[model samples]
Target chain A: MPPAALSVHLSIGQAYAWSVFKPPLESALGLSGTQSALPFQLGIVMLGLSAAFGGTLVERNGPRWAMTVALICFSSGFLLSSLGAATEQYWLIVLGYGFVGGIGLGIGYISPVSTLIKWFPDRPGMATGIAIMGFGGGALIASPWSAQMLESFGSDSSGIALAFLVHGLSYAVFMLLGVLLVRVPRSEKPVESAPSAFEGPQVSARNAVRTPQFWCLWVVLCMNVTAGIGILEKAAPMITDFFKGTSTPVSVSAAAGFVALLSAANMAGRIGWSSTSDLIGRKNIYRLYLGVGAVMYGLIALFGDSSKPLFILCALVILSFYGGGFATVPAYLKDLFGTYQVGAIHGRLLTAWSTAGVLGPLIVNWIADRQEEAGKSGSALYGLSFVIMIGLLVVGFVANELVRPVDVRHHIPAPREAADVGARQQPESA
Target chain B: MSEHDSSQSPPDRRPLIALAWVWVGAPLAYGLYELVQKATQLFTG
Candidate 1:
């Protein structure tokens, strides 16, 4: 019942690999990059929905059943997408990948998180980071492999269909690792010799929504994600557009590599950055994420067209932070709310992600499309979008600042038998 | 829990802040440079 490998596998197969299908899907459907990003957006939306609605189910059924359901939904989504691609039906791709698969993502994403925290109560931040790191890292492996398959299969409808079939079968096997391995801990005891200073305020799912803290964190996540994905979804075109008026141009193959590199950065951020949350505390770290992240975006907004190296460097840093924001947020929530219902609370909070999924791309793409129509070339079109991202990050920073310790009134008391928990702690203090 | 000093210390914040910066800075810089490089290549080439 060990939760480690299974969590990683499901994390990679379900969340990250879906992005691998974006390019081929776009090519086969003759859709633009923005249009192609729709599936990822929809899938992210579903991630929030499933997590919100299914957290209770996950708690009741345990990770085994939740992950099993995730495997089925996730794999079937690929199968269905395969069929859709073979038939040249774009809507099927939406339904299969975005809707059903997204549900799997939502469920699978949270399944291991709370369980890991329970198992490693002493290191809750690091534990959740270990599992969630897979979600970020998943894209790293999937993107290159997908690109290779597409190269071999020819980027046609049939090739794309085969890729989906392969993805379904492979992920089904991969996610099974988590389903088989994850185990709940036997004890509910706290791990620290002394309780963490920040541990007392246990907020329920219901109360969490009402607090200013929750809304602030929500804004922080939404803006962070929006900024990162806005660029991610449009990575290829945005890059290509940057130099349309210049003398040098990027080849399609190189653009694909650029995407791959971003995926690597995203993956690395999940593990490399988030685990650090255990030491620094989530709140202070987020200040940097929002504050410095906004500055990075501003640098790009102000001077991007003039200096290509500066632009790329700043974007990479921003995206790394973006990925780190995701990997670290669960730990942040754990800091604010005790582990009692962290998964459910996390699920509810994912609504921020769903909101960002839609708004980020809409802002970036719509503006870029308009600029293209207006005959704006080079980096001129992205000025407004980057500026908007800065504004959003500023809002998020304000929200993070608004976070405070949850009021004790918000805590739902435990059962009578557990009433002595307060007494046990009081005597220990004496 | 309420009796303990929950306020995070500078020692605690320093490492985490450093890690957060690495996470935030590395990817932000990398993604931007990569995108810009591609964009520039698109036009100049």
Candidate 2:
């Protein structure tokens, strides 16, 4: 199950590395920074929309069907994007990578989650953690690989198109492994007989969204993701700006290294912190992610320019929290609502990620661009953004605090009712 | 199948499990290597 999850996640996680293509696309296609970001931004938007709309279908048809659909859309998005680059049509790129590929990401992201939770009932956190960690690690592989490809092939439109074609073909083949290997648990019965951490009444995906607990979690996820992405989206440039005039000024290569380090932190946090949540309880672990995260942002804002080590350490911790937030949320959902329809609930929850994907980069980049226009240098460029992130994390902390067990009225009446409803509601194959 | 019977059911299953682990681990391992290579640039360059 973990392997199946990893195959899909590692392929789709390439979205995080889209920034590596930004400069080349901007130069070759004559686009502004905002224009270059449009594909990635729209892809995230589509990811949320597709996941939300497709969530119930995914739940109905099961993981194999969902994963197969993801494989086709994601691979085809790359092929279409290649044509877009070759033709120099920006809209094609957006349609291919953003709209089509985003659907792949959305479905692919949720595909294995519920199955893993069911298979590993005793440790939902660890189960989900292993798979989601691959999503964070995807960029670690793709960044250098894409960079090397562009270097070898030249950074022209034709070269970029070729790279896209290769990516599409390779990822399609890779994701197929997931489709073949994945299996729903043979027996629907809970593996563990003892009372586990996620003891709760089950909730259907349709009813789960109507509850206040779900909405509170939506806010919590949005704020946490927004805070983390603020740093992640700007990691390369922000570090250089922070130490522009220092004795050990950050070079472009070093800035790239910093991005790699952040990726490592992000991947590690997903596995480490989410696994920790199993022991500490989900709510308490989130308090650490939000409350401690706010403190980390404060440290960066206050003293980051004075010391590079302090800056890097603080950034790593913040990125870890960011990864932890993604990895832990599925288990948290299970804790509140039970395993029934968790994939759909998780798909619905990812809308918060889409929201943050847009809002985070906008807040950070807009502020930094304005600061640059105002002749700000060093830490001053990101100071306001960090303060805003701190404020956002504080709000998330409050939302996490307010989270409680879902009301019993929202739960499906019995296990058999859930099974019957699921069987009845099964949708046509994608 | 009983636990003992399942344990002895198929010798082929061991190879399949190993192959599956390799399929999953290879990409992750390669990713880690690339990250390490990138990180080394921070010190060497």
Candidate 3:
């Protein structure tokens, strides 16, 4: 199950590394920075929308079908974008990578989540962490691999097209391994001894959404993601800006290394913090992620520019919380709503991520851009944004505190009871 | 073979599991290598 999840996640997670293509696309297509961001932004929007809309379909069709569909849409998105690049048609790239490919990202993201939860009922957090860690690590492989490919192929339009083509074909074949291997557990076997309090009544996807716990969690995920993306979207530039006037100024190369370190932290936190959640309980784990996260942002806002190591340590911890927030959420949902229709519920919840996708980058970039215009330099450029992020994390912390078990009225009837009700309704057949 | 004989001689699943691990492990190894290479540049530069 982990491998199956990893295969799809590692491919779709390439979205994080989309910045690698920005410069090349800008130069080749004569586009502005905002224009280059259009496809990536649209892709994230599509990821949320498609996941929300396709959640029920995925639940009905099963993982194999969902995975196969994801493979087709994802690979074809790359292929179509390659054609767009080769022909120098910018709209096609948007349509292909952003719209069509985004559908793949949405469906693929939730494909293995429910299966792993069911398979490892004893350790739901750890199961999800294993899969989501791939999503965080995908950028690590892709950033350098794509850069090397662009270097080898030349940074021309033709080269970009070729790179896209290879990405499409390779990922298609790679994801097929998952498609062939994945399996739904035969039955929900009882755990020998359930340690957690989350073992409770099952809630339908429709009913799950109606609960207050769901909405509170939505706010939690949105604010947590927004804070993280603010840093991530500006990681490279922010580092350079922070130390611009120092004796040992940050080079572009070092900034790139900082991005790499953040990716490592992101990947590590997905697995490490989430596994810890299994032992510590989901709600307590999130307290650390949201509460400590705010403190990290505060530290950066106050003392970041004065010392390099302090800045890096704070940034790494903040990024870890970011990744932990994502990986931990599925298990948290399972705890609140039960494993029944978890994939669909997760899909619906991911709308928060799409909202954050736009909000996070916009807030940070807008503030930074305005600061630059006002003649602000160094850490002052990002000071306001960090303060705002601290506020967002505080809101997320309160939301996490508000979460509790679902009400009994919302739970679906037990299987035997449901069967009895079905028999009563269909007396002629009986 | 009879059903009993076939039941007694189950197909080996070790290789399939190993292949699945390989599918996951190979890419992870490559990614780690790339990260290490990038990290070295920070110090060496």
Candidate 4:
């Protein structure tokens, strides 16, 4: 299951590596940075939308069926992009990669999550962690690989088209392994997974939205992702900006290095911190991600340009919390909603990610633009944004504190004793 | 194979398990290697 899950995630995880195509596309297509950014942005929006809308279908069809659809949509998106590149029709690329491919991203991201949790009921956090870590690391594989392709293929339209062709076909082949390999539990219900003290009733995706707990987690995930992604989107520039007037001014290569290091932290955190959640529990892990994560932001804001290592260390920790936040959420959902309809519920929860995807970059870029207009330079450019991120994290922390077990009213009839416990305990607790 | 035995242990799946891990691990390692080469510039530069 882990390998099969990785086959799916690692392939679709290439979304993060889309930046490698930007400069080449800009040169080839005469695009602005903002224009080049459109497809990736739209892809993220579609990721959230598709996941929210498609979650129920995926649950109904099963992982094999889901993987097949993902393979087709994702691969065809690339093939279409290849044709778009060949014709130099930028809108075709957007439609292919953004609209069509984004559906693949959304479906593929959630495909293995519920199944892994169901299989590894005893360590749901670790199970989901192993799968999701691939999503974080996908860029590491694709970024350099894509760059090498561009280098070898000459960055022309034909070259870009060829690259897209290879990505489409190879990923299609890789994802098929997952389609062939994955299997659901032999038992009708996955063994009653109650790994933590804050276990909630087994709730269907339909009933989950009515409970305050779901919304609280929504806020929690939204704020956590928002804080982390803000730094991530601007990492290279942010590092360079910090030491703009310093003696040890950061070179562009060094800043790129900083970005890579942060990516590593993000990937490692997905596996390391999430697996840790299995022992420490999900809510407690989130307390670390949100509570301490805010402090890391405060540290970056306060200690500006004083020590390069300190700034890098703080940023890396925050990014790890970001990745950990993503990896751990599925288990967190399972803890609150149970295995029933968790995939669907998780899909709904990803709407928060789509929201944060827009929200995080907007806050950072808007504030920076304003500050730049006002002649603010150095860390001053990001001071207000950091403060806002810290505030958002605080808000998320409060929401996490407000999380309680789901009310029994939302629960599906449990297959075992776990059902009786929820039924009897504080029936209208919400 | 008995259901109890299948439930308790699948004794002969080690080679397939290792192969699966290697399949994913090799590419991941290559990616990590490239990333490390890039990341080293942060300190060394």
Candidate 5:
């Protein structure tokens, strides 16, 4: 399940490395920076939308169907984008890569999540974490490859089209493995909350939204994502500005290195800390993420310029928590909402990610722009943003604390109705 | 008999599973190598 999930995730994760295309696209298409950014931005927005909308269908159809759809949509997106590049039709690139490809990202992203939890009820976090880690790590593999492609083939129309063609074909073949390997594990009885302390509500996706628990988790996710992205979106410049006043100013190479380290931390935390959640319990783990994360932000705000090592360490740890938060939430949903409609519920929760995608960079960039206009430099430029991040973390902590078991009214009234989920007659060889 | 048998002789799937892991692991290893190569510039720079 993990390997199958990974095939899709690693393929789509290239969305994060879209910056590799920005310079080439600008030169080739005579595009502005923001124009080049449109496809990636739209991809994220589409990812959230498709996941939320398509989740129920994924649940109803089963993973094999879901994976096949992902392969078709995602690969076609690249092909269409290739044609767009060849023709110099910028709108085609946007529609193909951003709109169509984003749908692929959304569907591919959630395809394996609920199945993994169902497969390893005892270690839900670890199972999903391994796969989600692939998404985070995907950019690492893609960055150099995309750069190489652009170098070998000029970033011009024909060259870019050829690169997109190779990517599309390769991803199609790779994603096919997922379609072949994924199994809708024979649904046993609803996971016995059992002797385990983690047992809680069995709310359906529809009713889950009505309860305050859903919104609380929503707020928790939104705030956590906002804080992490605040740093990530501006990592290179933030690091450079933080230390410009110091004796050792951050070189561009060092700043690039810092971004790579954050990527590593993000990937590692996805697998490492999420597995830890299986042991410590989801709620307690979140307390550590939100609470400690806030302190890390506060420290950076107060004394970040005092030392480079401290600033770097704080940022790395916070980023790990950021990554951890992403990997842990599905299991957390399982604990609160049960495995009943976890995939559908997980899909809904991604709207928070879309929200943060917009808000995180806007808040950081806006404040930084204003501060620059006010003659601020170095660490001073971002002090208020860190404070705001800290405030967001504190809010997330409160939301995490407020998370409690769902009331009995939300559970499926009968045992048979509960058992009927994902228990289709189709045999699964997981 | 081949190490990976479809017959129900406990159908030793270790090799198949190992191959699966390797398929995913190889690319991840490449990504990690690049990541480390780039990350070293932090202290060196």
Candidate 6:
């Protein structure tokens, strides 16, 4: 089959590429693992912010404009990071990559989601997954490419600087492909004979915020993200640390490959697992994500350092589900609420991501740092963290269970003129 | 065509091209610098 939408694919690549920079950045800047991760963490934070604020703008002005802005910001961020590295200014790296580039990530990330959904209204889950799969898969390509670049460049401060520059430029050109190719579907009025799903009464954005389902989903996404990101942000070090007591300590190259492997799993989860949600329904898929995710954490906590394969397998599964959670949520929203303001709701819902972005890494890093200070080795330290993940997942599972069908009152009907749209499918049929 | 019409000239592509450079060229330049330096390091190392 032909490749998926270009914009969706590119955005995913851009987001996933951040991980490639993490290790070398840490080594070159003489930063700790947590410190090295801060840019990504903060970039995630800004992703929610920009997406939320710019969502309406995206809905009004269209994905093309939002994507254009994203290309500019994201590319500039790379250039800025390069400058920072060349000048030995860590703050600039954070500012450029985390803050500025993060905005690009947020905007670019959401740009394709709503647009893709509109194009494939019949298959919202699969469509969203197809787009989001890129975000997940982007890392797989980026990790190897980045590693190769670092290997070639010497892994020094200057080497990192060069990598940042190249990353900035290349991604900018690549992302521009999305900007150039993105086209809004023409607003064709439906014939009178056709029944319209979007033609019904509308729900205002203000009222949609008041519903319990919204808050329930908010909690669900927040907890799910926190669970997954805790593992992702610290994948390389966490894996090595978990295996520290093993007879065969993980080699640096091996650990990096492990990171790449986890990335592949993450990417694959976005497509394979999330696409499965379309068949099983969003709620059931989430049950698997949270319940299985919690179990995965438990397996880790209980089995610490005994079997490397088991540990890696569990972590990979958890990460995959984490990616699936992200990929599937947009479709979930479409299923619950109509697409009238899904983009807006999606933007609002991303606040959960921003919160998790901070909470996930903080919880993992803080616990790990404390454990290391206490001379806790291997599985012992992670036991408490995994327990916490379990609790979080349980909470998420409860939130998912709490999701009843969205109230009819919350539906944001199309504008009065467009109310009789015969082109769109009726919710009754859905 | 009138003298004024001839003098008016075609629309400037400079600003548009300049914008693309800032957006496009800047990132490429940075990436190239990094790639080149890294290539050199690999050779020397």
Top candidate, metric TM-score: 5
Worst 10 residues of 4 chain B by lDDT: B1-10
Report the Cα lDDT for residue A165, model 1. 92
Model 6 TM-score relative to the real fold = 0.77
How many clashes show up per model?
38, 0, 0, 0, 0, 13
Each candidate's fnat, listed in order, reads 0.01, 0.39, 0.36, 0.49, 0.47, 0.00
**Tens digit of per-residue lDDT, candidate 1, span A72-133:** 98889889999999999998988998898888888888877766665555566677666665
| Separate DockQ for every predicted complex | 0.04, 0.32, 0.27, 0.39, 0.34, 0.03
Model 4 bad stretches (over 4 Å): A188-200, A414-430, B1-9
Best DockQ among the predictions, by candidate number: 4
Candidate 6, residues A81-146: lDDT per residue as tens digits?
889999989999899988999888877787777666655555667777767766655554565577
- Top lDDT model: 4
Worst 10 residues of 5 chain A by lDDT: A189-198
Q: What is candidate 4's lDDT per residue for A1-430, written digit by digit as tens? A: 7898998899889999999999999999999999998889888898898889898887776777788888998999999999999999999899999999999999999988877876788788888888899998788999999999889988989999999999999999888878766766523244444442224457878888888999999999999999998899899899999999999899999998999999999999999899999899888999999999999999999996788888999999999999999999999999888866788899999999988988999999999999999999999999999999999999999999999988777776653454333222211211
Scanning candidate 3 chain A in windows of ten residues, the lowest lDDT window is A421-430
Candidate 5's clash total is 0
Q: If both were scored by TM-score, which would come out higher, candidate 1 or candidate 2?
A: 2
Return whichever of 2 and 5 wins on TM-score.
5
Clashing residue pairs found in predicted model 2 = none
User: Model 6, residue A319: displacement in angstroms?
Assistant: 1.3
Over 4 Å off in model 6, which ranges? A1-12, A19-41, A83-93, A150-165, A186-204, A240-252, A372-375, A413-430, B1-45
**Candidate 1 Cα outliers beyond 4 Å, as residue runs:** A1-41, A80-94, A147-163, A188-199, A243-254, A415-430, B1-45
Regarding DockQ, does 2 or 4 come out ahead? 4
Candidate 2 off by > 4 Å: A27-30, A86-90, A191-199, A372-375, A419-430, B1-11
Q: Looking at model 6, what is the TM-score of chain A? A: 0.83
* lDDT (tens digit, per residue) of candidate 2 on B4-33: 011122577677667777887887898899
Error of 1 at A364 (Å): 1.6
